[model samples]
Target: MEDRLVMDGLPAFGLEVGAFSSVDLVTAYFGRIADVSNLNAVTDPLHGIPILIKNNIASIENNNTAGSLALLGARTPRDAFVASRLRAAGAVILGKTGLSQWANFRSSNSSNGWSAHGGQVFGAYVQNQDPSGSSSGSGVSAALGLAAACLGTETDGSILSPAQRNGVVGIKPSVGLTSRDLVIPISEHQDTIGPMASDVKSAAYVLQAVAGQDPNDNYTSAIPNSIPTLPDYVAACNPDALSGARIGVPSNVLELFLDFDNSRQVEVTSFLSALSTIRRAGAEVVENTNFTELAAWANSSAETIVLRADFVTNLASYLSKLSFNPNNITSLADVSRFTKTVQPGPEEFPSRNTATWDAALDAQSGFGNTDPRFFPFLQENLFLGGEGGLLGALDRHDLDAIILPTSFAPGFAAIVGAPAVTVPLGFYPAGTPTVMNRRGNLVDTAEGVPYGISFLGRRFEEAKLIGFAFAFEQLTKVRGTVKPFVVPKTEIRRGV
Candidate 1:
């Protein structure tokens, strides 16, 4: 009667994100002893394969948090598009992973990975540390090998930060390539779901199985199924990808980190050295680019204004369509109210309200402080004037892609909606040599931490990005996996 589908080191089959291994996971993996006739077909699609989902996607008829307590006991009527694909691919629908409450758009001060239902997902390296949000649990689970891979959604950095903090591969697909009919929303313009895996190939495999045009999502109509269907990802891992490829180094992002964290210099040292490998690989590296104008443009008030408009407008439509009772609240207002209850179950709201309220207050203050010049600066300096911003930079330099660090530092913190990818460069040991800042100041590492160099491209260029990442990974293979609940033991690899 023991189900062959059951396996150790697999994720739970129920709904809670990053819920510890449980009887349910065991049952899902191995069919029930009494159900022999059905047991033959009960093989976990994800049998030996383990993966986690962001709490937003509904699978296994379990609770869908969307990182909000309002839907505490709510059961989504059906499996999300990606969840169905994961199941079909023979991947175990591991439990849902934690995320920033409401994908971190609900509040400004809302920590990146905290949710009333899941609390905070911890970093794989340091247990008492930040597992960068929205997709925090997915990144953590992938890094620790609690599962073979995991899924994470992003409006922005949610996928990237966790990947950076957990030291793994995180890819944010083109917005329209993947369907979003059942997943929670952030911004239709930017919201997307992608894979968080131990390496680039695994992430590509998940994407291959799940990506396609959906009848439900209108935005997807514009993207061709052939584009997402391309399988060159694994084949594109040419160690020679760097050769003949033009890479632009944004001096602006480096300067921004220089101002924020002195330790960033230590992280960049390995990154710069990694760039040398690109040169050794025969790529041309261009430095001393002035992208300051573009950097400031991205963080301006105009962007926030755009986000707010979409948040209110899109959310209203989504809530109006949902069919639910009073207990199953749907709107932001209802969620805010439900977050205040002191209940015993995961839906208990008192603690969550604190994070939500603080986020709201911070958002208001952040908006007020944003400068108006930032918008025109973007139009004139980056997009129009052609200094940088993916497309502009790529065309101006006649390049394949641009490279930059995924984060200012290797450590994690709270933030919402930023999608990023971290590939191996080389390790920056605890006492490694450091780099000089814009002001020509030198610095050293206080501790050993992993750092990565990133390649950026125009929107919808994930295939290129993945191809480049595959090449880089094949060359370096720096990513590592940890045995769950155990302390890390190896020196982190770089640029893999």
Candidate 2:
């Protein structure tokens, strides 16, 4: 396989400068392993496009590392439901991309996109800065055009944050819109996989190919029958789609970390810029939408106790059933101890291991019905009742959709089982707001990094979101490329 990839031409995005450091490595790998001759479609039909699947995802022929050494050499007996869908659609499975260890589930202060097996993945547009975590490599590879599209899973900020950093379009589908079977688990309740691509159209195409029913994932049952079919995602991109759409600018999401993360300012500035762009594109922009009235709900605890319990028990059971050896390490406690004693490879990227430690110590919270932290009512309704709440606003205003900064603000924060998406609005100015200090001071950082506003709407409203994004993209037409690298074109990889 390595020999067949030796004569590769440079990737369209030029990611092969110093070493096989980016998606070029993925493209090269696919050319070696797959019989890609029958595939067709690049960014449009998505049939034959080369796709970089995150390491956490299962590909029968590849290792499912989840960016951790713990799963080293563990081969999946079959493809993940999503991976199978891609193959059936004629897509080539490009090699896996590097990611934060355990999708940044290990610690709190961990760096983004640093994996033990693949090292650190840089934001292609700005090589020096962090590529926001968990699914960071998938985002970077897509941005560099290593493949026409890539698959990224999100449990919170993983997908969206990296997409913003890498200058690409990412969609973290509704909780159950995509299947979770065969993908390494964080929290079954919130885990989902979606497409990350160079543009919204490409992302939409990939999403269509992968979003559908699966016996392995019962969640797909919740998908509505009224929505247009997956292949029709491009229809959402009406140039006038935003013409009369009412966009809600939630002031509270903007203030979520105001006291601790000053990066909010840089993001706020960018959000304002995006709002202006939306208005110029002819949308009805409503600034200062409030979600604070539901603060109790928005800030409600995630009931991680339930999540942890499920993880340990379920994981142990799953491992036991596997044909592979069940190490003396069966619980999170054992895994934590193992990680502490072993030094990962130099290319390894680390996420905050402290969080994993915290989760492990508190695993008992999930053990029995005795723990008060186990299961609690989903108290807040940010997605439910307020003017800024997703459903409420959409119903009240008869809006076509709404847009936000894609996140509270970006920095390095990891949470398991949450989902979201990020899109590129083009480059942000120097000294963009970033890192926060204990003193509550905001530090300006990550100059030359890309910043994008996020579009979120009612659950299952992906079509609207994608359409709106496509409309914005068509208006701006700001395609980005990675900083040039000096290397042989023959060493780079192309699409599947």
Candidate 3:
């Protein structure tokens, strides 16, 4: 396969016409990824496609380490539900991409894409770009077309942020849309698995393969029973889907992020220009729709209180279910000890420290979500993200979906487990000044760095978001406008 060859199993992959065999595609993608995969008989949209999964998601063929050395060699009894679904849908498991250690929940001081086992993953957009968290590897690899696309999990910004930085399309489904069983957890309440792909349609195909209710993950039970069969997400990619659709731009959300991350001006200008695109595309734009208590909501401790408590409980549950544990790491505390004690060390325990885990453990009250404090915090979260936040904004503005620059969107939706999709919006100008990451090793912002626009909606509404994203994606086609510092040499390594 060639380098940077963007595909979402586009028509004429040569498989259906017998131009090449599934084995041929596999061998072509060999250097890009590898693993145990059987050619399936069915012809799903994802069939015969090569896809990479983030390291945190468990699989039988490789060590499911979540980018941490502590769980090295640990084995999962079976593939994570998403992995099995991908295989069943005929996607070849190319290989696992590296991720932020413990999905970027381990250390507050850590770099976005750094991992103990994989070192650090740098984006191809520029030298040492911050590759944005948790799903960092998946996002960058997708943009460079390392595989057909890559899978990622989001507790909050894991998938979206990385996708935006890498100039790829990412869909962060509602909490229960995809199963979490066997995928490592940060907070069961917030964690979700979704795809980061070169385009929205490809993402839809990847999502179509894995989405549906799973008995193992109770959260999936929340998916509406009225719809007996999974919706055909690919069919939802209507170019005219945005025509007559009511889309709102929450000015307050944009206000909150105006000075965030120091990469502005272009985004603000691009966003203003994109609103005209949205209007010209026939979507009714509702501007200045404010989140009634956004400031109060953002200032509250409810989200943090809920996440830390859930993490303590969720991590223990995931470890307990692991079939084989080399380190006997049964709880968050046990894992913490291993990180600090492991010597000749890449963990950099003394300097980095387990501050995030320390805080989680400190909040650990010998109970999980069932604790008395949990429900109240959840209630506050729902009020903020639900009634007074995005939900209220949608209902009050009588909108189909709310749009914001991707940077401003994730947190609000995360609280309510609402679905969101981030599509390429714009890139920084050529003369833009560079901004270095906190650790000062990676570039946080600079000329040619890409950003995105997100469409956030009510729970289980991904199909709608996909349609709007596809429409916006088609309108701007921004990904192609920005060129990376380095483009891959080959689009494909053809196999005979």
Candidate 4:
């Protein structure tokens, strides 16, 4: 299955990457499959499943490039905590998938899926449309069934956006639910590894295998010992889970992007239909909740200040732990200098410039977490995104989860370290361009594109989110219908 998909033109892997040989896969199945092995000790729930991990997450056998030329040959001495857990649970480590260069933090104008090391990753549904990233390859591989499931890390929309664009199920667990040890850092506050799969159940299965506390990561200490376990996650897939649930629709959030002049009417219509479906499934729909304060913060300088500061400090710390740094690339400043000497100039790779990195380095000048400016950013984020923000809105409204258009809701979750599950809603017709009055341009809108809706819930409430997503998925049956792309023989021959 893996080789066949690669042959069919799926550019989902990074350097020195290869799938497990057939013999090894068969052996793993025989040793761990419940039907093949009856040993009481062999109780791995993910037995025989093949998982493709994102390149940024360290794997002992694969080079962890984090989609940058600066770390071209860097390999970790051990697997990331999540990767080790997956292996312990009997999952086959397939390979590392491509991602945006530096996980989309390299430049302000960097195109999604365009990595200096792995090139551009295309979407399975539309060959020429944007395959949102920096989880580009993971999402595409899952959507195309290249592997049973894939792992993706999110600082913000890295996991959710790509999953939505590729029409797959993506769950961004609460920050500490999955350990971040050995994974490349964007922001400790927001960076988390999650699963992207063809369905919510598969995603939940992967999540169960990976979610746990790791002593190496202090954040995981916050995860309660009695947190939802694997069985709870599986059981939550009940189709009737939405009954009597109250879902809030923040008009302030939706209207931020659903302007009439934009070409997102199709998306708006699909969202309304989804709301109707949720209501039909016995979930009460709360309309037009005012989240003006939270929405304002979403566009404020707080996010930029916090993320930039965190990126510099966290990335330097991560680099300092490397067992081998052949190039001595120890800081963001070094990375910035290295890229300029080798990569294409701004004329071509507009997003690979050093401006962002420079700014981050400047922000961290002799200032650690003690910087007064830094604390305000974190304090404001906690207030607007925490108890006084998203949590406040939910508590005040007495809602189960907030249902927002998939497009912008992920950002809110990232800021607050909340968990969110996105599932397919529907697709727009061919030639239907996305909203033109937006941050990025829509590519190949002439080809039909898929849109998904997200269910955002309180921190560590993944079971509820997964259950709600599963119910909606079962009711809608919106996934699995989109056909995978098969490259033309002529194009393959020409290496196009």
How are the candidates ranked when ordered by TM-score, highest leading?
3, 4, 2, 1
lDDT of 4 by residue, 221-296 (tens): 7776534433367678889999999999888766767653356667778898788899999999998765647556
lDDT by residue (1-496, candidate 2, tens digit) is: 3322332122323443443434455544344323221111111111234677888888777777776666676665688889998888766676677777777776666567666666656555543456677787787666555566789888667788778767778888876778887887776655688888878777877788788878878878777752245436767767777887888775666676565566556667767777887998888998665554445544545434444544655455444433443345555666666676666534222323456556546634335323454444222222323332555555666666656665562211112122334667656565554543222221114556676777766666778778788888777765543341211233343333
TM-score of 2: 0.78
TM-scores for candidates 1 onward, in order: 0.75, 0.78, 0.93, 0.85
Residue pairs with backbone overlap in model 4: 431-446
> Could you give candidate 3's per-residue lDDT for residues 1-496 as a string of tens digits?
3323333343235667665556656555553332201110001112245788898888778778887888898988999999999888877677788788899987878888887777788875877788888898888778766677789999888999999998999999999999999998988889999999899998999999889888999999888842357677899999998999999988877777775543576787788889999999999999998899888886898888788889888889899988889889999899999999999887888677688888877744434676887898889998999889999998998999999888778998999999999999988887888899888888988888889999999898898999999999988888878676655443343343
Which wins on lDDT, candidate 2 or candidate 3?
3
**Candidate achieving the largest TM-score:** 3
Higher-scoring candidate on TM-score, 1 or 3 = 3
Worst-scoring 10-residue span by lDDT in model 2: 37-46
> Which residue runs does candidate 1 get wrong by more than 4 Å?
1-49, 224-231, 295-299, 320-328, 341-388, 408-420, 426-428, 431-448, 481-496
- Residue-level lDDT of model 1, residues 1-496, one tens digit each, is 2222312222234224533334444343233211221111111133333566788776755567676656666555567888887787666575677777787776544445666676655555542445567787787666655555788887657776677666778787766777787787756656778888777777777777677677877776756445446545556555666667777776766777777776667567767777777777777888854453555454544444434444544554555545443375655555666666545645444433444333333445322113453344223422422333445556667767667777742111001112234675543454544442222221112123345656666545667777777777766667653232333222111121
lDDT for position 81 in model 4: 95
Clash totals for all candidate models: 29, 19, 9, 1
By lDDT, the better pick of 2 and 4 is: 4
